[model samples]
Target: MAKATRWRNFTRSEAFSGYVLVSPTAIYAVLLLAAPLATIVAFSFFKDGYLTVIREFTLQNYVDTWSDPVFRAILLRSLFVSGMVTLTTVLIAFPIAYYISFNVSRSMKSRWLFLITIPFWTSYLIRVFLWKVILGYNGVINSTLDIVGLIDQPLNMLNNVQAIVVTLAHAYAPFAILPIFVALEKIDRALLEAGQDLGESRLMTFWRVTLPLAMPGVVAAVLIVFIPTIGDYVTPQLIGGGKVPMVANLIQARMLDLDNKPMGSAIAVSAMAIVTLVSLLFLFLNRRFLRVQK
Candidate 1:
């Protein structure tokens, strides 16, 4: 009777429903995400032949991937561009998120969030193309500047690293903002009030109490912006004008243009490894701040 009662409780507990609820997503991840990731990792160890992947296991693909100067340059450039975009997006986003959380009335907060997400109403590819148009020679900015006599000729804005950064920062702004807003909203108002009561200035209280509490959202914002921007293909292709190729472009070139799947897989693995290490390092460095809000 006791065993039967325990079994009945177990069936209705959150642990059971949690499993039931998560099973579909877990299965989907295993089939769609893990399987392809395993395939890529497996291919990274194989050898590339003339229009064929050699089944023989070897470390030569990784060795050659690391040895290539072009790959190193492109990978470094990708990291730099992604880092700039993350910084630009987060720094700009924090203020907007704070304003919405602390200043906007509860009634108006939804409208503000709605406005923030207006950029998402359009397709991402269309947005990238729009950025291309904005920064292109004889495009909106150049045309307006010329009309106002700002320069002698149209500037070469497109096909550069800066253009890539600007396009990505704008694209990922909403992502950064939402996470940060969620974080800022979770902060207790009493904590800020207590800090001020304890003789801390508003700025100092925010520095000590507010920012630390919001660190998780900030970290989430950083990782969300950083990871995808590093692997971005469309922005580099459109905004960089195919001249400033990042890691994604190189991977595409290897996988498709050169028909070297192993080499492409190797590059992809290396990039994933680097991103993982950077993300771990960031988490480690921010462990203190993460513990604060708790």
Candidate 2:
């Protein structure tokens, strides 16, 4: 039959093979990513009983989350901290990325990149703890200052927002750098030569030509640093000394400590929503830059 033959032909096709190749990843995504998200979304709408999540649908969880002053302040603080980290990371990363892309020889570039990743050789937790040691009351800076007779008292460096920002900015610096470096590397050097030939100064040429071509990488770096830093629990907990808890810490407290799954789910959902919107905005900017690059 014609229909039977058509079905048989399709099964033998490359398109079918492509689908077969992709099916495992697709299945994994659905099971792990989509299912967890759906479960959280369902839990966020349910009511919280003493130690149990009531199946009854309610919007009160969201209402309570949004209405709480503490939650609002913490959420705003998370945003501010992430924005500051993103700004700081990108500003610092650009020069390093630029130096690697423009100044370093191709043979030496790999060595430079390897050195940049040297921090990742240690466990992330160990790195954070090391920061705590350096920033604590009697830590490196204060001890050195005291030894040098610079100060009588050890400075209170930890347990503050500034400390959180510093720790996070350092941890996520490489994430920002790699993408911008990739972007800078993609730019054609001949374009720079052409700009100079057209009577443009190096600074002006960079501002007009190099920077625009590199915007996609910078945008990628922003999303990379911004998203994870906003939801970060470890740096805020370990470095900020529990005093400057972010949304992740609050969600952990609500979910585990309080045994209020529904409330925790609501807070988690709200945080996800905020992150989603910000991510989309940057993704839009990335697309615009891509089109311009084209």
Candidate 3:
């Protein structure tokens, strides 16, 4: 009876409730995320051959991955492409977010949000293919240009880095917009009024007050777009015509085509490290900016 009473009391406690609330997520992360990551890390230290992995430990995977010029070039290009996509997405998203948050009536906001999310209803691969059709030689753009007599031949728009960036930017626009809208909606209206009362113009008020308050959402949008884009194989493969290969494509080739799991794991680990470092740097800068604002 005493043990039962103590157990019941403990279960009723706030700390116990907190643990119960978080236990599901903790278990899910351990099972789904951490376990796979640990396996990949372990794989990175082993020797791999065609269709086989040796149990022997080696750092040669990492050494070879870094030393190869092709890998180095592809890694750098992947970072550049991801950065461009993030920038383009955020720039395009901000105006739409600002308008939706500030200009739209509350009753219509839901409808606006739904419209923004309409693209999600379609398959991602379908969207990529649609962009290919629009940009391809003798496709929509070229046909239109030809009809207008603007160009004598197809503009060579498809199968390039620019096409990949544009497609990715469009795909990630909704992700960027929602966070920024949330951030903008949370800003105190009184602050904007105060700025105006102090004789600031609308543009000045926005520059001094609105943009700073919205930085957190903008940062979130950047990370959301950048990380996955760096590892994206589909867009580059389909749009880049094998002319532009990102790190993820290289990893896939190593793992499947060459049957070298160790090299693929090493590349994946290195890419993760780079992304982690960049994310941490952005967070650190954001924190410092917040402190200075305070």
Candidate 4:
């Protein structure tokens, strides 16, 4: 009884210390993320236009946003592009992650993982621009095709939807791969042995054991890749040829170009709501799958 009481006292003190340590980060998030988000919410409901001080509450901005065809189109395009990029990244990253996790020596695994990190040391804009140069009409792809006599004229590679997906996929591939690799590495060798002992073939063992165990990584990869790529405006602007605009671009144009702050805030809030809903759905599915496996 005395020991149990002492252990409880020790746990209470440790919990207090841990909270003390995390308190600064919690405060920082409030100062940065919470404050700005609250301000955006407040501004989203403001009555008048940019200059008008109509402090009265109104849903006019949201109504206008929903009615705008351009905003709706932009939102759909963002979802499509982000979905494509996320799927492609996962497909490409999966095999690489599997090989590294299951086949490579520990020493080589560390080296290759380090190589992935090397790309992050450079400017993101510079890396993206490199893709632009490679995919441009007069760029390496065109030059190669021309030299091979594949076509008479340069292909219009710039300012297109394909270019946006390709560039974003390339940019975000590491994010997908790392999570998958970590998950794959966490898998137990005993599970494979158990499957084999149960007369499962190699493919069956992988399907029944490996894939199920690594699903958390898969979900993580998808969420990480999908969420940001869908909201990205820069890649769309650079490679989407000004012809295709994602929701982010629309928000940017409304906020800065058109000087319509209320509409922009409304759009921002709506996007946040959509993202939150999607994320919750993903989490629910992940948990359901996890429970089934168990």
Candidate 5:
């Protein structure tokens, strides 16, 4: 009777209720995410064989992965492309978000948000292909230029890093905009009025107050864009025309085309490690900034 009463009391407690609520999600994450990640990590350490993983543990995959100059170049290119995409996306997103957050009335914000999300309703693949058509030789831009007598022949615009960046920035614009809009919306109106009342210029007030508070959203947008774009296979493969292979392309070639699963896994693991380190570094800096602000 006493034990039953104690158990009932424990179950009714706030902490127990919280754990119970979270248990399903925790279990789901362990099964879906943790299990697959562990398998990949295991595969990275094993030897590669024809159509099968060799039973022997070996570091040859890592050695080969690190020793190759091509892999290094691809890795650097992936990082550069992702960084550019993140920067461009954030820079473009901030103004649109600011307009919606500050200039638009509260009653119309939902409609504007819906408009912002309209692009997401379409297929991502279709968007990429559309950009390909736009940038291709003899395509819309080139034909327009030719008709306008701006050039004697079509300009070669497709299948390059710039094209890839442009496509990715367009694709990820919504992701960057939404978070920043949320951050901006959360800012107290009184704070702005306070700055103005203190005799600060509008630009000075924004520089000193608004941007600092919005750093969290900016960081979130950066991570959201950078991490996935770095490992993207489709944009670089299609838009880049295989001339500029990112890390994901290399991993795909290794695992599928080259029949080297272990090496691919090693490369994948290494990429995950780098991404984790970068994420942690960003989080640390964000925390430090918050502490200093406080």
Candidate 6:
């Protein structure tokens, strides 16, 4: 009885110490994330426009935002762009991840990994702007095609959906690759050997063993790529040439240009809700995938 009491006391002391050690991080999170979220939620209910606060509750903002055609179009366009970007980044990154984890030698793998991530060392804005120059009317792409007699005139490549997708893909590809690579790296080599020993083909082993183990990374990459692309304002504005209006742009214009703070807040809230839903769905899928593998 004495020993049991001593162990219980020791466990309680350890738990208290652990909480004390983590208290700093908890306080930071409350300040940075929780506090701001609470502010946004509170602001959503207030009757405020620009510099004036009416201190009353109203649903007119949501009503007007939902009724606006332009806002709806921007929301839809944001979804489409984020979806395409996620799909393209994942599909392209998977093969590179597969090769790195399963095929390459150790020395070559390090070199190739360095090469893949080296693009990120450059300025992000400069990289996106380079695409702008390349796709412009007098850009290198058009000049090269003309020189090769493949085209008589420059193609209309700039300020379009294609430009936005290409730019975003380049920017987000590393995120997809890194997660999948981490998942692939965690897989045991012995599992593959055992599968082969049981007469499973390479493709069969990959489908059953490799892919299942790499699912956590896949889900992580999807969330990372999709979440940011959905809210990206700069890429669409710069490359989309004012033709495509994402949800972020619409919200910004509403708040800054039109002085419609209420509608802007509504749009912001709507976008946040969509993002929250997608993130939850991704988590569910990831949990399901993990369970199936088990």
lDDT of each: 0.95, 0.93, 0.93, 0.88, 0.91, 0.87
For 90-189, candidate 4 gives per-residue lDDT tens digits of 9999999999998999889999898877878888788888988999889999999999999899999988888999999999999999999999999998
Please identify which of the two predictions, 1 or 6, would achieve the higher lDDT against the true structure. 1
Estimate TM-scores for all models.
Answer: 0.94, 0.94, 0.94, 0.92, 0.93, 0.88
Q: What is the lDDT of residue 160 in candidate 1?
A: 93
Candidate 6 minimal-lDDT segment of 10 residues = 46-55
- Candidate 6 displacement at residue 112 in angstroms: 2.7
Candidate 2: segments with Cα more than 4 A from true spot:
1-3, 283-294
For candidate 3, lDDT tens digit of each residue in 1-294?
999999999999999999999999999999999999999999999998668899789999999999999999999999999999999999999999999999999999999999999999999999999999999997899999999999998999977899999999999999999999999999999999999999999998997799889998999999999999999988999989878999999999999988889999999999999999988998899888877766
lDDT of 5 by residue, 105-169 (tens): 98999999999999999999999999989999868999999998999989888789999999999
Q: Which runs in model 5 stand beyond 4 Å of their true positions?
A: 1-8, 287-294
Alpha carbon lDDT of residue 64, candidate 3? 96
How do these models rank on TM-score, best leading? 2, 3, 1, 5, 4, 6
TM-score of 6: 0.88
lDDT of 1 by residue, 1-294 (tens): 999999999999999999999999999999999999999999999999999999999999999999999999999999999999999999999999999999999999999999999999999999999988999887999999999998989999999999999999999999999999999999999999999999999999998899998998999999999999999999998888799999999999999999999999999999999999999999988995556644
Q: Enumerate residue pairs that collide in model 5.
A: none
What local lDDT score does residue 202 receive in model 4, on the 0 to 100 scale?
Answer: 91
For model 6, how does the per-residue alpha-carbon lDDT over 1-294 read when each residue is reduced to its tens digit?
Answer: 999998788768978789889999999999999997776666566776556555578887788778988878888888888999999999999999989987899879888889899988998888888888989898999999999999988999987787899999999999899889999999999999999999999999888898888888998899999999999988888898878879988888977888766667778888899888988987988788768767
- Among all candidates shown, the one with the greatest lDDT: 1
Q: What is the lDDT of residue 52 in candidate 1?
A: 98
| Candidate 2 per-residue C-alpha lDDT over 24-125 given as tens digits, one digit per residue, 9 for 90 to 100 | 999999999999999999999999999888999999999999999989999999999999999999999999999999999999999999999999999889
